[model samples]
Target: MLKVQEIRELIKLIDHSSIEEFTFEHDGSKIKMKKNTGTSVSVVKTVGQPVEIPSAEVVHKPVVQEVPVEKAATVNAEVIQEKVEIESVTDLHKITSPMVGTFYESPTPDTDAYVKVGSKVSKDSIVCIVEAMKLFNEIEAEVEGEIVEVLVKNGQLVEFGQPLFLVKPE
Candidate 1:
């Protein structure tokens, strides 16, 4: 496997050079890179696999410096209030998804939700379930608190360590 710095250097070399495409094969590994008309560069890499798949593109956008205008310097009160609310919530505990799966608030469609905003929960309480690979896994609160927010909706795909709920401690 190529190190991060080596890969970055390769990208830099490709970006600075006039070469439109480059291909490399070694041992059981293969790498192909192509520069397109847009800001994205396509890269295909496979290791000992005889499968053809669409190449993944890496987009590099030029950074633009923002010049502040005197009129725009004035802050909106509503924006300040929203920021304050966000700051306050940052201190609250978060219940994150343990795995990548579909989130379910209830065990069945006909049943009541396991948790909702303002619901009190103990560390062992089942706050929700995550369905992964067709297997339903119950998710615990892991903390004693009141549910302040449900970050994901039913049937929504959740990622590992993704925040599923916000809780305010009792």
Candidate 2:
């Protein structure tokens, strides 16, 4: 049986890292855990074989309840205000990464970034570059807008579908 502390620790470990899957095995029992890609935690368990344990027996217990870190951080007025400003500045048409790669805001290190917050852009504008497998793929805006938010920092590894920018329609 899994202890509550173990489960809670596992959850925290998964939440703080980019790993999406984990598994464990012990004493003829196996447990597998996975992080939901859609911003939530889901736990699933499977019993491999029938044991003499009672049907009403609880296999796991809830651990010490920790305050959600992100929620706690957002309770600050400054954080909330910043979030509101970002939302107000843009309707948030997201520009998403088309491939898994390192995101670059400019074509070259010495050049100015292709777009910055508040830069007006057209539908055909190339807003950034994603370098994958040594090839630089120009990321374009599909809608006309003003760039309002940059979701990823320069040189960061971005996964497919990760939002790179938020744009307010012009």
Candidate 3:
């Protein structure tokens, strides 16, 4: 078992890093963490230049104690019928981000958003923009549909494959 303080420290460290996922296992116990992806961790050198570092992990040794033999542990689970109520939800088309970046709802703050709830889009419709490293990339709808939901707010960092909109296909 991990101490609460140790877990807190790890959370804080990961929160400050660009690691998208982390996992640790020891003595039959495991911990997994996933973060909203965006930038990467960088180190500053004497030249005052930033050098990006690849994601890395740190592992700690596990403590163990011998115990007397006993009956094997048994696991129990109960499965209830999940809300099968919305088969229609699976029919909605998802507009996903092509790359990790800052999401933009319009070309500029002064302009109206390209699409909104109930907005009709075509295969070539410019639905939104994604800015990465000062590059503004116009994203297209790629499918004919009516927008049902906008998943992220303007200027929010979006990860690759993150759903940006839900559209009801025309």
For model 3, where is the 10-residue window of minimal lDDT?
A: 74-83
Ranking by lDDT: 2, 1, 3
Question: What TM-score, over all chains together, does every model reach?
Answer: 0.52, 0.57, 0.52
lDDT of each: 0.74, 0.77, 0.73
As a TM-score, model 1 comes out at 0.52
Candidate order by decreasing TM-score: 2, 1, 3
Error (Å) of candidate 3 at residue 161 is: 0.4
Whose lDDT is greatest here? 2
Candidate 2, which ten residues in sequence have the lowest lDDT sum?
A: 60-69
lDDT by residue (tens digit), candidate 3, 54-91: 33333443333322222222211111112122224788
Better of 1 and 2 by TM-score: 2
| Candidate 2 residue-wise lDDT, 52-134, digit = tens | 33445545422223343354443454555676688775457999999999999998899999999999999999999999999
lDDT of 1 by residue, 103-170 (tens): 99999999999999999999999999999999999999999999987878888888899999988887
For model 2, what is the alpha-carbon lDDT of residue 136? 95
